[model samples]
Target: MARGKEYGYLLDGLNSERAEMIKRALRAIPEIKSISIRPSQGTIQLIATKDPETQVKIACEVAGCVFRLKLGRGQLA
Candidate 1:
């Protein structure tokens, strides 16, 4: 998919079920190449094209979560 930027976030009240739902929602977004969740670490990592913040926010909303901390941005390996 020629993935572009990598994004990471700490979403409040994260759990395995919520993370699973969030991942499902994010998959529907074409810009997102992939999604990773570190439940033990409370991290959500995304490899996406263009700007995914807004869509990420929406996906989180659908999962009943709000971003608590932005883990920052980076390039996908």
Candidate 2:
């Protein structure tokens, strides 16, 4: 996918509480530069210095949920 392109994923079965927990966990990763919630897809987009694989691993470990990461440059960045 092109940089800055919006990616989508299904975060089904996760309620607001769980989503917040996941967001907290993801934010805990120092390498994660930033994060934004894509409510439409129920997915969280993370802007990180670390690679997608590493970010996903940390997210899974902390949130106890499977996550997929897509790399894209932010238009404003």
Candidate 3:
């Protein structure tokens, strides 16, 4: 069976540059399966195999950004 989980995050106070940095940071971790970002809404939607909260926290720290847990439409899968 597939054991993957999805998570959505809403990043505040981020521009294109900051979003890029965060993407790189998250991609560096193997646990992060996929990453999607919306610059207009500052939303980062991710698919992770495990421990998404920790992974996102570290990525945000590395990127010097802050985020909140906000699930968008159809993001709970």
Candidate 4:
């Protein structure tokens, strides 16, 4: 392991109003080792024990927000 593999997301429709809910949803998952969200940049950074896309998708749904993923190449890691 190289410390941790950072997985990132370019949020399609994130705004201040929905940030808290999404952050809260992310926090519910224990495998996520790190989290950083920049509402202004419309991006989210995460490091987890495993791939987090599925959990992220679920969180977005639970928060009732629509999103589009960035490069099919995957997140920032």
Higher-ranked by TM-score: 2 or 4 = 4
In candidate 1, stretches whose alpha carbon ends up further than 4 angstroms from where it belongs are 73-77
Per-prediction TM-score to the true structure, in the order listed: 0.82, 0.54, 0.76, 0.78
Order of all candidates by lDDT, from best down to worst?
1, 3, 4, 2
The prediction achieving the highest lDDT against the true structure is 1
lDDT at position 7, candidate 1: 84
In TM-score terms, which candidate is top?
1
Ranking by TM-score: 1, 4, 3, 2
After TM-score superposition, the amount by which residue 74's alpha carbon in candidate 3 deviates from its true location, in angstroms, is 5.4
Worst 10 residues of 3 by lDDT: 68-77
Of the candidates numbered 2 and 3, which has the greater lDDT value?
A: 3
Q: In model 4, what lDDT does residue 32 have?
A: 86
Cα-based RMSD of candidate 4: 2.9
Name model 4 segments beyond 4 Å from true: 1-3, 70-77
On the 0 to 100 scale, the lDDT of residue 47 in model 2 is 61
Measured by C-alpha RMSD in angstroms, how accurate is candidate 3? 2.7
- Which residue runs does candidate 3 get wrong by more than 4 Å? 1-3, 70-77
Against the true structure, candidate 4 reaches a TM-score of: 0.78
